[model samples]
Structures are given as C-alpha cells and as structure tokens.
Target chain A: MTTTTIQQDLYPTRTGEVPGPAIEREHPTVWGSEADGPFDAAALEAHEQRGFTILENFITPSEVDLYSAELRRLSADQSLAGDPRVITEKSTGAVRSVFEVTALSEAIDALSRDPRVLDRARQLLGSDVYLHQTRVNYMPGFKGSGFYWHSDFETWHAEDGMPAPRAVSCSIALTPNYPYNGGLMVMPGSHRTYAPGVGETPADNHSSSLKEQTVGVPSQEAVTEMAHRYGIDQFTGPAGSALWFDSNIMHGSGNNITPFPRSNVFMVFNSVENTLEDPYAAPTPRPEHIASRDFTPLR
Target chain B: MTTTTIQQDLYPTRTGEVPGPAIEREHPTVWGSEADGPFDAAALEAHEQRGFTILENFITPSEVDLYSAELRRLSADQSLAGDPRVITEKSTGAVRSVFEVTALSEAIDALSRDPRVLDRARQLLGSDVYLHQTRVNYMPGFKGSGFYWHSDFETWHAEDGMPAPRAVSCSIALTPNYPYNGGLMVMPGSHRTYAPGVGETPADNHSSSLKEQTVGVPSQEAVTEMAHRYGIDQFTGPAGSALWFDSNIMHGSGNNITPFPRSNVFMVFNSVENTLEDPYAAPTPRPEHIASRDFTPLR
Candidate 1:
C-alpha cells in the first residue's frame, strides 16, 4: 500500500505560542496493558503510578568494574577528542557524556541486548523494542554541572520527531550515588502530565543543550506545582543499581560538589512500532548519535 | 490512529538467496506523473529515457569560485579532523569527502535551497522534496580513489530504509572534470532496471564501505552487460556544470592518475512521500549525516 500520507503529530512543543509551561494529560503512563516477563508486580505497579522503578543489584560487582573501566577508557581515548559523539563539559572541558555507547563498544552492545535488560524494556513498551539512544554520562568530582528540570519527550518530540512517550530509559549506575553527590531527582507521578515548554528550538540545539540546557525546560512555577503535588524523590543507591523511568517524566540532577564522582550508563529503549518521522517543531532532527533513527529491534 | 502495524518491505536484498545480480523492472522513472516547472519538455524526456540530464554552466564563474573556496576551507578545517562527518582516503590521509555539507556551511545550505535546483527536484519526484544527503566529494591529483559500479538505491533501500527509488542526485562540479581525472560514468537507460546485488550486507557497513565499497557491488558480468547494452558515458565538463541523475542508475568512476583534481558538491533530493522506515536488508540504518531521516520539505 502507498504510504504517502503524513500523520499528525500528537505531542507538540517549542512552538513559542505558550507563554509558560502548560501541563496536559499524557498519552499513556504504561503502553503495555499487561505486565509480564522479568518485571515483578510491585515494580510494574510502581512504574505505572510513580513513573519510575528501581532495581538493586542489577549487575554484579565485577560487571560494574568492567563497565567502569570501559567508561574510563572511552573518556580518555584521544581518537574521540573532537568527535560530535563525545560531549565535553562547558567549563572544565572534561568529558561529560559519550553518546552511542553501544555502537562504539562491543561490551556495552552486549549488555544492551542482554535479556535481563531487553526483556524488561519489551514488557514496558508492550512490543519489540529498539535502542533509541545510549550514552555514558560522567559527573566529575568538584566541577560537574547540573541539569535543569525537563521532560525528555518534550525535546524528543519537538526536535527528534518521537511520535509518543512509548519509550523507557534505564540508567545503570557505575559509581555510588549518595545524597549530596548530585543524585537524580524525579517528581513522582509526574509522568501522568506532559509539560509543554515555551520557546522555539534553535537549529543545532543539541550541540548546546546537551552541555547546558537553556531551552525546552519547564517553567519554575510549573515545576513548583508539580513538586508540591507529587513531591521529589532522589535516587540514591550503590553501584550496579538500575533505575527505569518513563521518557516524559520530570527529572533532573544537582551539581556535584563533593569529593565523589557519579557515572552511569544510560540506555533508552523505544517501541519498534513508534518510529521517528519529521520534526514537529525544530528545523531539523538531532544527530543519530543522540537520537537514533535505526528501528531494528535488539535481538 | 494507532500505527502498530508494520508495513511489508517492497524491495528486499542481501537475503543470501540470489546467486548473482538479477535485473528487475523499476517502479517508475518519474513519479510526478505530470511535469511542470523549470524543466523543459526535452530535459524531462531525457531524464525519463536516459535517466540523466546535464545543464551547462548552471552556476556563474564567480559563484563557482565562491563554492570552491568554501570547499577548500572545509577540507582544511582542523576542527573536523576526527569527526565522523569527514571521510579521508584509505591510503593517504587526504580528505576525500565531507558529508552534511549543507549543515556545515551556510553558503552550501543556501545553494541547496535555490529554486533552480529545488524546483526541478519537486517536479521530477512529483511531490514536495527534502534534502536526503549532501556532501562534497574530492579526488586529489595523484592518489585519488574510484568508486565501484553500483546503484545507490540498493544500499539506500538495503541499509538506509529508503522505501522507493524516488530520489535524484545533483552533482555540481567545483573543479574541471577532465577525462583523465576521475569523473562520473553512467550507463544510459540503466535506471529503468533495478539490479539486485549478491552477498549479505555486513553490520556497520558504512564505516568501511564509504571509503572503499567491497560489498553490495554489482557483479563484473552485470556491469559489462549493462555497458554493452546502454553504453557507458563519462561526465566531462567545466567547473559550475551540473549533472542530475536518477538514484538507481548504474554509475561509477575511474581512479584519477592525472595532475588535475576533480571535485564536486553532491546533493540528493528525495520525495517527502517516501520517508525511511526499518532497513530492508542490513542490520541497522546508516548515520544521519550519510542518509538523512528528516522528511521536512525544503521551503
């Protein structure tokens, strides 16, 4: 059949029409109507209600060491110095994030396809899943910066052309996360609401936004209302721990001023059925390393 | 409407079933049923019959100088040393190609949107067109490499998930295209046949194929037969001359042993009606720089 017809975009952001962040009902908290596979009943319920679930000891201590070593090697690799996939900190010039980790390393690619991780993603997305984006985020001890509160789907839908929030992100901690060392903070139950950010997304926004996001961030008033309604929860855990969260949930992290560093391997799994199309608001989509266009399911 | 249903792949290749190159009927040389715009009747008919058309002195001499200077500056940019968008020769470290030229330079971006070029693309594709890929290919004086005989749509369909052959490529010469130097050679009337190549496409094929294509190349017998039937034509012209050809035509070039360097800015325009989906043969889609996933029509 001919597919010349272009579908309408469901979630729109960065249109510059809204004066401030506007909250709207989400498409669906959980796409998979029934829970199965490795996810337990409580974990699935928590994911549906609170928009997130934490799994302790997702990897062994030795596995964590392997991943940490890989991350360190990737950070120090001189070959990736000026590559667009390697993002450095704004002030310190230290490697802040390494995008497309799976494509760059075979160890990470294997982990992405591991049934332990892949099964849960399939259960959550309610269909076969593909890697939307994968990266290793590093926050060095004293000079690491902070990320502002924002929904990933906002930027993804506006800039990357993601059709829906039928995607999930799993962050596997490679270093210990303490309360003072800039652990991730999420507004529980915020996944039920979609906060549309105000402003037009500039061309090549990812080059800057990945360093320090100034656009597609929810207004302070909107963040306060959401925080008051659901309350904020910080994810503090040991190495090898994992946190699975919805794509549209309100989340951010504070600066790390302590003596300890925090690093994590983040992987986003998107439903194969919900592939990308044209951008809804921005002039062009982000690079493939940041938002992958490949929809081949992880085997 | 929910798009959970995955469509059937129209063109399948690299399945390891075909023993040799198989020629099949093409979908359509001209999708735009009715042609109207800047193209004259003869030019359009030539495109339909011969699968290519050449416009002499498409850009003024001064404009050619401007583009040549831009291309030189881009080639010598130290900032793009290790960038994935920049490809260098396998033998020599000399820069060979620079992908995403429009995104890297404002002058080239404006050239891509010029009505003289964009209007013809829309007229031939029979719909609104978007920039599918743009790059500046440079073959230096002595050590220049040559491309093997292959149809681009085979790779685009097998690896980039381009559904149809409704795409056109415009190559504007930045330097003199002498017969001695490496210049594009095409078989007239070859675009009407879809020649399926043999062998399986390896994973991450673009990393190596971009430098020297070893896979997805039509057999030597197939090339000889096509050359005997349609006859081989070399594109030899002055700077600023432009050649527009169908995407699926059998084309390749010989190595430049001459002192004259041949350079051209290549721009590919795809019908917006034919956007990307999952790859039909390969394991993953190529990077966005090589094969764009964006479907936003040029306005």
Candidate 2:
C-alpha cells in the first residue's frame, strides 16, 4: 500500500473542526530517519508540525538500565533519608515525585548534560538551553493517580514568570510504557490552540498533593472535542525510547491500576533567550524544586 | 502628655513626599479608646492611612501559649517526618519555615478562625476573607536568615492569581519580636508606591532556601531613599501581640545571627472577592504549600 493509504488507514481523522486538507498530509510518527543523528533538521520540522516527536532508541538498553538504576537509588535514598524534595502520597506513601534529581544525583546530572539530550534541546529551541527543572515522576502500581487534561506552559508562564512557551520537556522512559500502564497521551496539533483555563482542584492526598492547585485544565467537553479533532496519540514505547514535546501540548495520563511501574525522568529545557522572570513581583512563592531560578545556560 | 503630642512624638513624619495636609494632621497612634471590639471603623481608617494596625493583646496569654505549643508540636512532628513543606537552612539545619501550618495543627486552624483575626480581616478587606495560606516562620537564634524587601501583593498578583491587593497578613507573635532579633521592618507608606522592581538576588540559603526567588525588590538606593523619607517601623511586640498589615506594604527582616528566636505565625487572609486565579493558564506549577487552592471561606 502507498504511504498515504497506510496513514489514512492507521489514523482515521475524526470528524470535527480539523479540516480535511490538513489530514491528507502524512504526519511523521518517528522523528528522525535511521540515518539521522540525535539532532537533525527533520526532527525539528516534525516537532514544528506536530508539536512532539518521539526518538526511538534514543538511549541504548544499557544506558537506560544505568539511568534507571540511578533513579531507583536516588528514590531509595530520598525516601529513606526523608528528603524534603520527595513527595509521597499521603494515603499510600507511593512516591509521586522527587524534584531536582540532577542536583541530588551525580549520575542523573551527568545524564542530563549528555549531548544526546542537550544537543537536541539546542536544535529544537534554536538557541542554548538551560535546565529549567528536573524531576523523576513515579507512577507506581495499583494506586498510581492520573493527571487532568492540561498544558504545562499555562502554569509555567502564569506561575514561574516564564516569558514565553519556548521550552520543551524531554521525557526519557526508564520503563516500558504499555497501553494499559497509564502512559502519557497527547492531542496532536493541540499546541496551536492555547486553551485558557485555570482553577483549583480538590485536595488529593494520593497525588500532586499540595493543596491540589491547578490552572488551565480544559473542560471535559472541550478536551473531548480537541481530542476528536486533533486525534489522540499514546506514547507507548520500550525503556530506551524518548519523547521531546513542546511545553504547551494538551496532555495527561490514565490511572495506573496496573501492576507494573511506569517511571520516567523529565528534564525541562528552557531557552536562554526565553528565560522567565518572577511571575509575582515578590519573593519566589515556589520552592526551587517546583520552579527553578538557576538560568545558567547548558553548554 | 496629650494624645496628639504623643502621636506626633512617637511617629514623627519622616521628610519627603507623603503628601501635604495628610502628614500635618495627627495620625491615630492607637485605634480604639476602650469599648471597641476587634473590628472597628477607627481600626480600618488607621489601616487605610498607615497600612497596618497593632491589635494590642488580641490574644490572651493562655491562648498564645496554646497556639505556640501547637506550632512547636507541629514543627517538631513535621521535622521528624521530613515533611516536604518544612524547609530548613541547608547549612544550619535550622528550620527556616513550616508551611501550611493550619492543615496539620488543630490549634492553629482554630486560631485562624478566631473572630479577632477573621472579623478584622473581613473589615479590612471589605469582604469575607478566606484562608490563603499559613506558615510558622522560625527565625532561629544565631542562624536565622533575613528576607529581602518586597511587597506580598507583588507575589500574590504575579505568582498566585490574586486579582487585587485585598488581603492582610495577621502576624501573631509566637515569640517577642525584638529589634535586634531580626523582626519585620516595614516602610510606613510604601504600600501606596507599589514599587516595580524584579530581579534575582545573591543566593541566600539561610532564608528562602528553596530558590531564593524574589521580585519587585527596591534597589538599595531606592530602599535607602524610601527608608530616609518614610522611616522604618519595626513590628516589635510582646508574645500575645498581633499586627495586621496590608499585602502591598514593602517589608523584610534582618539576619538573626542574634541569639534569640523571632518566630511568628503568619496567617494570610485573602478577600473572597479578590480570590486568585492561576497566575498562568496551565496546571498548577506550584506545590500547594506556597500558593493554596483552597478557597473555603473562613467561618
């Protein structure tokens, strides 16, 4: 079959506001061809078109194992030592997140600075990038909670004083992301439309536990419409797969009632030219782990 | 001596642009004479003019003891548990702050709801007040840190989605705020100015240990000029004393490299009408302790 026929068969565009002409063209599933290195013009073009691109086998299996081991070690140390950065669910004590992982673990720090990630960040951002923040998010088995539909740039700009949405979150999968394991789901082309919604959520002890403050959570109806129009994409991959996504992409995950763990390390790379100032004209309201102030450019 | 003379003597108008006839007239040094409750017209007027009011002996000694004990217990419990909200100085391990104190301690929750604080908050804000957030700040002896000059409104408006400066921070002194002990110092008429300064400061781990993020900090020259024009007022008082100040008033503290604790419990009451939306249109970037999403009005 022809590539266009295959594309049409695979991704049947749902009827709605997304025009028919837009769907006729092929959207590249994988970022780079087998011949391209980690950073390339094709990857940038795909990212510009779809607002996200998954780089298959970005890290070797051995490297993934090393990064996974480092994360587990850090998580164990933080949990054991009662590190203030470690936020566990109040009810289950399931590790929800551990922030500033690069600061605490030398191995993770080295991994963050690796050319494979940083070089691509530079290419995508079209400038030197700085580490906005780093965190290891653990979606544990059984009680792993799901996040509501939202765009991260909305919060970063509103809260962190980020001047623009010129940033990307590089999600390096340390574990296999399966269909039923509550992996990330993105609405393709949703980045073009910046949905404006902001409100507070009910306090949840099992996840994002601090007061459950939220912003820019698109309504269920709106999200459904957007998903139908844009088409939903699941980021299911092996441990070494990597996804580089724009900050403003509409995304969320399902509850991982599954038995396996779906852990990933996310490094937010903000462009040097797009560094944010204080959102509030007061002392930084957030702790460094939540919104970092260090704007030192990554080499 | 006459009350006017005492007022004039106690608060001599510092040289500079506080305005003409306003400076000449005797500002009420005290709010009520004898038979007034916590919420009074005079108290509001004083607050409007000078941006603060000293509610003398708002809490009885016994009540103070109860709240203080509860704070100490909660602080100890959180420290022992390594609560993520409890931030300690990296070098000294001295507790810099314990956030969301009302969530953990019943005594504090009750104290926050007390008529003395809430009723006054209602009066000042011209609307029912909701609990914005609470913290027990520990300015430990010797190693206690100092904060830079900035208006709380700057943060509230920029970071927390607070629409207006319709908020008051009722600071109940847990320990005596002595001059040498690094207590709060306010620029008497700075609320009217709303000086717009935003930048990064020299990293200070002793206070604001998270990221040392700050905004609208008046330049040293401006601060010197403001201090010279509007003389600084220290909120030094006995243990049972309470001071209610406007959110926009520029204030800060000194380094308690001194041998005394200047701990205080600050309950921020935001006007219901002026409740904050998200600073950005995204998922809440902040953990709840810094900017609460709970808009449940204080009964």
Candidate 3:
C-alpha cells in the first residue's frame, strides 16, 4: 500500500475569507492559484526567518479522499484492553492510540517525501531529513476533540541532554479546516525564533503539570500571555495544504465544534541536528527555550 | 557522601495507637532490635499475594531529619530554578533530566536496592529493570501540591517516535502520610489493572490542560470511591521508613493541613524494554480522555 499525501490546492490563499467548509468557487483567490510545488530555496529561507511557512497544494483533494477511505478501513474493532478505546494518562505523549497507524497509502508516501515538506525541515534543522511519524486525527462530533496551546519539542528534546539542536514539524490538512473546525492555530514565524517557553521536563513527563512553576519550560498560560501581545492567528486552510514550523514554536488547535470531522496528518520531520541523540528520542532543549528568538528569517 | 539504604524491618504499621504525629516512636523495632528486617522474604511473598508490600527501615530516621533540614536550608531563597536541596518533584524519580544522575542518599539508596522493592516490582512487571527518574515532594500548608496517578513507564519509557513499551514507577513514601496531613491516597494495586471510564471535558483549559490531566492521573471521583471501599492508608511514617507501590496505580494526595511538611520521595524505575525512538523526544503520551487501552480494573 502506497502512502497518499494530502496535497490538494483546490483553494489556495496567501490570505483571505480563510476558506471554510463552503467551497470558494466563484470567490476570488488571494494567493496564487497553481500548486506552489516543492518548497524552493526561497521558501526555505523565508521559513527560517519567519519561524513558520505554509505550502499550498501540498496534497490534492483526491489524495485526502484516499486518506479518509484508508483510515476508515483501518479503524475496525480496535479495542485494546477494555473499551473500544481507553482514556488513560502516561508521563509522555497525549495519545489517541485507538487510531493506530494505518498502512501508508501510495499518495501519502509522496506527500511525506515531497521536498516541499522535507526540504523545509532540512532548512530549519540544518541537516538531512526523515519523517518523524505520520499521524491522523479524527475529531468525533467535532465537539473540540482536543485543544491546548503548548510546545511540541519541550517533551521530545531530553531537557538539556543533547548538543546542536534542530527540530521541526510539518502538518498537512486533509479537509477544509477553519477555526470552527479546530484548525491549526499558530504564532506566525514563531518556531526557531523563540526561546523554549516552558523549561525542560522529560520525553515521558510532557503533561504531568502546567509549564510555569515546573522545571525549565514556561507554563502554557505564560506563553499565551506573551503570545497575546503579538496577535496570534488561527491556521485555517483547505485540503492538500501544509504548515512548517520549528519544534520549539508555541502552537495548538481549537476543537471541531461543528458536525464536521476535522482531520489532519502531521508529517513531522527533523534534521540530523534535531534527532542526533537517539534519532527517536527528543527531550525539551533548555537553551532554545531561553533565547526567545524571532522566526521571520526562516521564511 | 556515602549513600545509605533503609533497613527492611522499619516501615511503620499500626503500633496499637491512633494515627498521629507522635506515634512515630511507637512501632515495633524490626531491624536494630533484630536483623529479620521489615519482613522476611516469606512475609513479603504473602503480602504480594494480597497486593502491596511494606519495607521497614527503608530510610533511617536520621537521614529523614537530614533531608528535611536540607530542605529548610535551601527554601529560603526566592529563586529555585536549579537548587539541588529543596526536595520537590525532581527529587521523585519520574522525569529524566540533567539532575537525574546524582548521589542517592543512603536512605534512598537503601530503598533503591531493597529486595522487597525489587521483588514487588519484579512480580508486577515480570522483567528486569532500569531506573527512570526520582523526585521528592514537600507538601506543606493548606494547598499542597497535586499529582496525577499514572505509570512512569507507561507515560515515559521510550522516545516519542520509538515503539518501546512502557516502564513502571515505584513510589516509596518516607513518612506516615495520613489524611489529616494530606498523605498520599492510592487505588489498591491499580497498576496491574486498568479500566477506561466515561470521558468528560475538564472545566479548565486555558493552560496545560493535557498535562494537567496527565499529572492529575486519577479523577477526583475515582479516588474517592476507592478510598471509601479499600480505605487507603495515608503514607505517614517516621524517617527511615518507606512504602512501595505501582507507578500507574490511581492515586493522589490531600491538602497538608498540619504544621509540618508532608514529605515523600518517589524513585522511578523502568524496564530495559523502554527504548528511545526519536533520539530527541518522547511525544506527549495520550491523556486518560483519549488512551486506547483497558484501564478499568476497579469495576
């Protein structure tokens, strides 16, 4: 089974009405119409400077269809130990394991390998790249399946354990995700530019407590208080779209409040500098949390 | 400094007196009086059959006084970012970080190597072991600190992208934590058992909601039910005392209302099976509201 990437560009926009479920047929498109293609040297440079960048037409609408069909096929009788799905807490990742890995479809593979996704990761991390993990989120009843603004790498990068860090995440939306559908909300170009908000915890102790009074990581509240002054925007867009941001960037999403099942696959990528420790184990890097860099240059 | 271990024959049990602070000296002397230790391998074996083991003299009284004195010495300063003596969460073995590798005081060292501790863990895990992380909690005043009931290994064993299984956490309480002092209250042997409950959205979400759910492992209602039935004994022992239980065991502490601080240090241990994948991370594990395993053992 080949991995089908979500690279649809039915609706591309540099900025505007922020396409919702309603298709913008006769509506004037704000961004370029054609697929922007793989991230070029220009896109790479822009992302590093800005902390985040968006790739248009990263996957097609049909490809997203393929992802949904395959996901449906994979969700059969998945009850683990007790219920159809258990709701438990560990020290590490916030999981939804009931949605296990669906064998990557053909279209998914191409999208993950798409230079637009990998090269951008390479540019920020300063090294060769590889997919961290491909994940599919299914928001049932869209009643805010999940929402909380926080950093990703703070849990992966083993608090002050490794050297010369470079880590990044690339998210591709499979459906039209607006703020109402729990779209990815992010602080523009805020990735590599900012200092690690919350200090270091462990790869396992991600959500054990709030960020503020903990270790090296700041609390999400603290990050929000700071991000508010900068005017953060919700990352909403159409299918076949992509987002590249530094692992250290503070980000989160709203819950899908509507009947629509908001879905997205984060094709996370990291450079040699980022995954150097164990390639599979990244904890929060304290130095990055302290510098509080700016993200505009990467763009 | 020489690391000393707790003797096996000293964990304080009911000495025919009501549970109170002054009862510290009323328990029978097992180690110094005789070398039989906390309980013989046979008694421990029996206790294991019944679920839960008590290791006496886990830490010497003198050592407890020393650590408590050290906490008093360091807490005076306003800044506690990296001070090593305050006796907080890091002092408990949960999150792996920079200060993770340090001297294990003789008291802790003893508990670390306790045969009873090992025997119980071996029975629960059915495998070899690795030390995860350690921390100490000084719950003082009306509003004491709170922690979620979760497994250290289940939450933090492998790196985020890696497929390593979970490890387990072993909490060894040094003092007789009672309800009045807001001692720790845990679900009886919930680690070996798991059950999913009805999912509900927490009221607060402006912060680290996910992590809040993780550290606050057990729901308030769940713990209350277990306490009513099994009658959770608050961990309230004198110095050189300790109690061992499963990391994932559903549990939490009450407010510390008495004058003195409610003290305890948890040293986390993991099995070798917990390998890293992302070399730089351990993704945030799934919270209780979204895990996919059978965690309901209470029913």
TM of chain B, each: 0.95, 0.80, 0.55
Tens-digit lDDT track for model 1 on A1-299? 77787676556576674634455664766666444578777677778999999889999999999989999999999999999999999897999899999988899999999988999999998889999999998998645656778898888888888888999999999998865456787888998888877788888888999998778877666776786687777787999999999999999875653336799999999999889977777899999999999999889
Top candidate (lDDT): 1
Residue pairs in collision within model 1? B32-B126
Model 3 has fnat of 0.00
- Which of candidates 1 and 3 reaches a greater TM-score? 1
Query: lDDT by residue for model 3 over A236-274, one digit each (tens)?
Result: 678778777766565654333233456566655544433
TM-score of each: 0.49, 0.43, 0.36
TM-score of chain A of each: 0.95, 0.80, 0.63
Query: Which residue segments of model 2 deviate by more than 4 Å?
Result: A1-38, A78-82, A200-214, A280-284, B1-299
Error of 1 at A82 (Å): 0.4
Give candidate 1 regions above 4 Å deviation.
Answer: A1-8, A17-21, A33-35, B1-299
State the TM-score for model 1.
Answer: 0.49
The all-Cα superposition gives candidate 1 an RMSD in Å to the true structure of 26.3
Question: Which candidate order results from sorting by lDDT in descending order?
Answer: 1, 2, 3
**lDDT at B29 for candidate 3?**
11
Cand. 1 Cα-lDDT: 0.83
Residue A114 in candidate 1, Cα distance off native in Å: 0.7
